[model samples]
Target: MYVYDEHDRQIAAERVAQFRDQTERALAGELSEDEFLPLRLQNGLYVQRLAPMLRIAVPYGMLRSEQLRRLARVTRDYDKGYAHFTTRQNVQLNWPALEDVPDILAELAEVEMHANQTSGNCIRNTTTDQFSGVQVDEVADPRPYCEIIRQWSTFHPEFAFLPRKFKVAVNASEKTDRAAIQVHDIGLQMVRNDQGELGFRVHVGGGLGRTPMVGPVIREFLPELDLLTYLEAVLRVYNRYGRRDNKFKARIKILVKALTPEGFAEKVEAEWSHIKDSPTRLTREAIERIQGYFTEPAYDALENATELLASQRFDNRQFDQWLSHNVDSHKKPGYAIVTLTMKKTGTPPGDVSDTQLEQIAELAEQYSFGEVRVTHQQNVVLADVRQDQLFELWQSIEPMGFATANLNTLTDVICCPGGDYCALANAKSIPVAESIQRRFDDKDFLYDLGDIDLNISGCMNACGHHHVGNIGVLGVDKKGAEFYQVSLGGSSHHDATIGKILGPSFAQEDMPDVIAKIIDVYVDNRKEEEPFLETYRRIGIEPFKERVYA
Candidate 1:
């Protein structure tokens, strides 16, 4: 958890006061809905289906135990007794009164958090790998950079009103947990060359909506120091030439397509010529200062793996199962990265009750290093769990219904609130997610379909990230009736690609069988022990398409 500096604290406090006035003016009818729309959006307030939903920005999904406790208090005091963690690494409270939004923002600001740029047509929260600092393969933690970008973009005078909402994601690892980078407005991947100099691989114009595109690599390697200046050039190009006539065609992705990656790169290169190495360019000192914020947490050195923990693994089959699926390798010895799954069998994915949030906070103090991370996959992560205490932690979490061992499995579905909460939605996505989970509840069956990512969204904003799942399902409306569109072959890892739609949409009731048929295709054709992605790549979508359509 990066603590805010005096400057950071001041800006957040001032911004709250500004938003409070904006909210009061809007409510008092001094500000019309048109005038208030962007203002409210900038504060992460959305007037959705039934009420105002406040999306609290959790930058890079990183949080301190105290911050998590504040969020729990926010949910308990203001809205319902729970909150929905979104795929963008943000959290949403569904039932906030429009007037109380200012107070909510004030509460968040007290904890050095805010909803700035959370929903506006400006740069949104800069998401990064949840395990940025803790993961073994990470080149460097991306959070400091994310925080810098957050500060720069907060009220960027020129970009306040863009053609459409813009998103930027940074990943510093060899593996891409921050998926489908090819589909973001800007994707930054930290890279080291043969010379061992650090920089980034810049991808531009990747996005998913009605038109999904894998971002094109415009710059193979940009020196890390020129990050801000180079980014400004990219945004300058998009802000100047991006479409304003049609909202549907206004995204940077559309403009990138219109210009082509090569041509776009030329434009950006030309702009960068004047701005590169400018005063805004990051200096060694700046980089060091930012890196200092994310320096590794102190860990006790314990070289030996506890034999007692090894024995406990075999003694409790349930704990063994949890260790197998929910635990990830840690860079530290005698410690593990534990994913506290929220995708329990029958509940809505990412919906954490107030009590569970408090429990997680307590657990972070007792087991983890007083920190927890909310992952993009809608689960809580206890980043540094001691191996010896694994069984006790499992015992604590299992009763709260948080120990479902479905990480990367089909049952570990990423879903949005959908029609139940979203006004933009055409059908219910949560129920569909549950139905799919029910059909694949058997662990043996799920394990056979190894490392499958199933994502669903009620409508086309692709909030559920349906465009990048190994098995993607999109809900739609046909003549006022609910239906789902299935797609296959999409992935969100290092080799990211968008899934292709199968055919005509299927009726809602037909989804379970359709899913079963797709799995059957995998089972019948997969070469021994091959994962879903490997099998899909080797066999292509032809066989699955045949089985699914037939």
Candidate 2:
């Protein structure tokens, strides 16, 4: 975890002071709603359906125990006792009073936390893989670079008010894209060339919403030193040319489409040719300083816990299932990455109560080096749990409702707070998520189906990333009546693909049946134990569509 330096602390504190004054003015009627709108949005506060929702950035989904405790405190005092974790790897407080927001933000600053850059048409949180430093599959940790960008874009004057909000994701995993890089405004995949020097393969224009696209690779290999300058070039181009007339057409993806990836790349390259060697270009020392902040925790000298874990697995089937689903391979032999699922049944996918947050903080401090990671899947990661203590950790978390052995399963659905909290939503997503959860609450069935991503969004904003789900559900308003649309074969992992709609949308009551029919088709056509995505690919969407509509 990157600790805030004095500069970081001072900047956050200053922002609190600035926002406090703005909020006070707004509350006193000195600043009208129109004037305060952007100011409040810039601070991550949204006037949603029923109340003011404040989104707190968990930069790259990283958090410390103390920070988690602080978040728990804010949830306890300012709003509802539970807060919803969002798909952007951020947390949202849905019931905060307008007058209390500044105080909440000030309290957040006490723990080096803030709500800055979490919303508005600016660069949002720069997210990456939750298992960045600890995972075995990474070529290099992407957090240092994410941290670099976070610092650069926090309040960059020139790019502060772009035509539309921009998102950037960085991933170094050679085999997996937990960051879903292809769907971001800018995607940086760290790669090592023939000389084995790390750099990035840059992709641009990818996004999902009204127009879903898998970005084209703009740069095959950008040297590590040129990271910031190259990024500057990309943003400069988008800031200059991205549409400003229509909100729907304002995204960089639209620009990428109009100019074509090659043309856009040429534009960025031309811009980079001038500033590539400027002070903005990262130097070896600067890179090292950032990298040093993410140094691996002081690990214990212990043998591989393979035999011990296996013994425990044999003794308990539940433990074995959880180990298979929730645990990930760590870079260290004796350690594992534990995903504490927030997808347990009856709860909105990522809602965490204050007490649960406090307990998780305690568990992280005791078992995982006092660090926790919020995942894009709306889960939490204890990235360095010793394998020897896996069983105990599992036992401890299950009662907290965080040990649902459904990582990447159908039940481990990623969802957004739709009509329930979002004014922009046409229909409620929580009930749909709950309905699907109840339909397949059976652990054995979900496990049998293999890895399937079922994502739901309240609307086309795609906050739930429904377009990437293996079974995608989007809530639509049909003549003032709520309906659910289904898409099959969508994936955000390797070779990311946007799903195709099955057929006509259905009434809300029929969503689970539609999903079950899609499942039935997959189970029927699957080859061996093929995953839902693989089966969908092999048989094409026709079978699933036919079964779903039939």
Number of the top TM-score candidate: 2
- Each model's TM-score? 0.98, 0.99
List runs of model 2 lying over 4 Å from the truth: none
| Cand. 1 Cα-lDDT | 0.88
Which stretch of 10 consecutive residues in model 2 shows the poorest summed lDDT? 541-550
- The candidate that wins on lDDT is 2
- TM-score, cand. 2: 0.99
Q: Write the per-residue lDDT of candidate 2 for residues 503-523, one digit (tens) a residue.
A: 889999998888888888888
The worst-scoring run of ten residues by lDDT in candidate 1 lies at: 175-184
TM-score result, candidate 1:
0.98
Instruction: Residues 1-550, candidate 1: write the lDDT tens digits.
Output: 5689898898889998998898889889999999999988988999999999999999888878788888899999999999998988899999999888889888988887788889988999888888877788988778888877876787899889999999999999886655446678999988987799888899999888889888989999998888899999999999999999999999999999999999999999999999887887888998787778777767898764668767888888878888889988888898888999999978899999888888999999999878888888999899998887788899999999889998989999999999999999999998889988998889977876788899999999899889999999999999999999999988777788999888899987889889999999999988988998889889888898889888
Off by over 4 Å in 1: 304-306
